[model samples]
Target: MEVVNQFVVSPCVSVCEVDERDICVGCLRTLDEIARWGVMSHEERMHVMTELLPLREAGDVT
Candidate 1:
């Protein structure tokens, strides 16, 4: 696998809201994930991006 050196393209769609489970409605990131994004390494952000699917499927976000 290749490691990307730039900040992962943010999944945010300008609609920022967290559901009761703490998942963002816009990007499907949890509150902790969102809070940590700015300081996270590029690879870290990418990993977080990849983790969104399960959150979405689990009904955490639309």
Candidate 2:
């Protein structure tokens, strides 16, 4: 068996303020996402960092 280590870092930019929509203005994560980040799996964190955050930044997602 191979042991693989995976680490997904948080996207917090130290702004730490939610907008009117309850999305973080710095990291572009929803309040729920932020709250669940620590408990989320590696894949989930990657999804947020790679897919979701980009869409949010591009205004493709609300």
Candidate 3:
């Protein structure tokens, strides 16, 4: 028998909300990105993170 490994995703249990600065208090996802995450591709998520990094550094969100 062969054993397979499964990947687990983050739970994002934070109750953070999207602030006017476009950062989620919890997940820190931008408003536009968060609104589109369900339909976005993995590449898109990567792009969003690129945009988010700067904001995070500036203390925009958690």
Candidate 4:
């Protein structure tokens, strides 16, 4: 038997404050994303970590 463990780490840095745009200044996640993190699937989390967060950080996203 083989076991595969999948864990999606949170980007929170303890700076829990949302900007005027409702994005977290610490983790760079939007308020909705942060609120939904606990219930989001692995793929969803990956999208946030890989795509959304990067775009947000780069100022490409709102």
Candidate 5:
């Protein structure tokens, strides 16, 4: 049997802190999402990335 390996990039911009909106401005991810990323499904991570892309385009970096 072969195992399917999925991978993702770390969203670290140096500063690590969760904002009032529960999203990490640096990584554009929610604190809970970040904590559970390693075990999250590929589809779930993709969803997070989709949510992040717009914020990045909007210059919402931290």
Candidate 6:
């Protein structure tokens, strides 16, 4: 039997606090996105990662 493992890495960065906009101060991911990470596919995870960089650069951090 062949075992296929699909893994999507998280960019938690160990700072797990949410800002006023409900976005994580560490990863800049919303509460919903963080919650859905486990079930999200590799593509979905990559999409979210791609979206986060802009938000982080826009000063989403606290």
Candidate 6: list runs displaced more than 4 Å.
1-6, 59-62
Deviation from native of the Cα of residue 61 in model 5, angstroms: 14
Model 4 per-residue lDDT tens digits across residues 1-62: 89766689999999999899999999999888999999999999999999998999999997
What is candidate 2's local distance difference test score? 0.93
Question: What C-alpha root-mean-square deviation, in Å, does candidate 4 show against the real structure?
Answer: 1.4
Tens-digit lDDT track of model 5 for 1-62:
99867676766676788777777767777788789989998888877777664665486742
Which sections of candidate 1 miss by over 4 Å? 1-5, 54-62
In terms of lDDT, the best-performing candidate is: 2
Give stretches of model 3 more than 4 Å off.
1-11, 54-62
> On TM-score, who's better, 1 or 6?
6
| Ten contiguous residues minimizing lDDT sum, candidate 4 | 1-10
The digit string of per-residue lDDT tens for model 3 on 1-62 reads 99654332322447667677767767666666667777777666665556665568577744
lDDT of model 2 at position 8: 86
Q: Is candidate 1 or candidate 4 better by lDDT?
A: 4
Native-to-model Cα distance after best TM-score fit, residue 54 in candidate 4, in Å: 0.7
**Order of the predicted models by lDDT, top scorer first:** 2, 4, 6, 1, 5, 3
Residues 1-62 of candidate 1: C-alpha lDDT, one tens digit per residue: 99756857778788999888887777788788888889998778877777655658686644
C-alpha TM-score for every candidate: 0.69, 0.90, 0.52, 0.90, 0.65, 0.72
Measured with C-alpha atoms, the lDDT of residue 43 in candidate 3 is 64
Q: Which ten residues in a row have the lowest lDDT in candidate 3?
A: 4-13
lDDT for residue 12 in candidate 6, whole number 0-100: 86
Which lDDT value does model 4 have at 22? 93
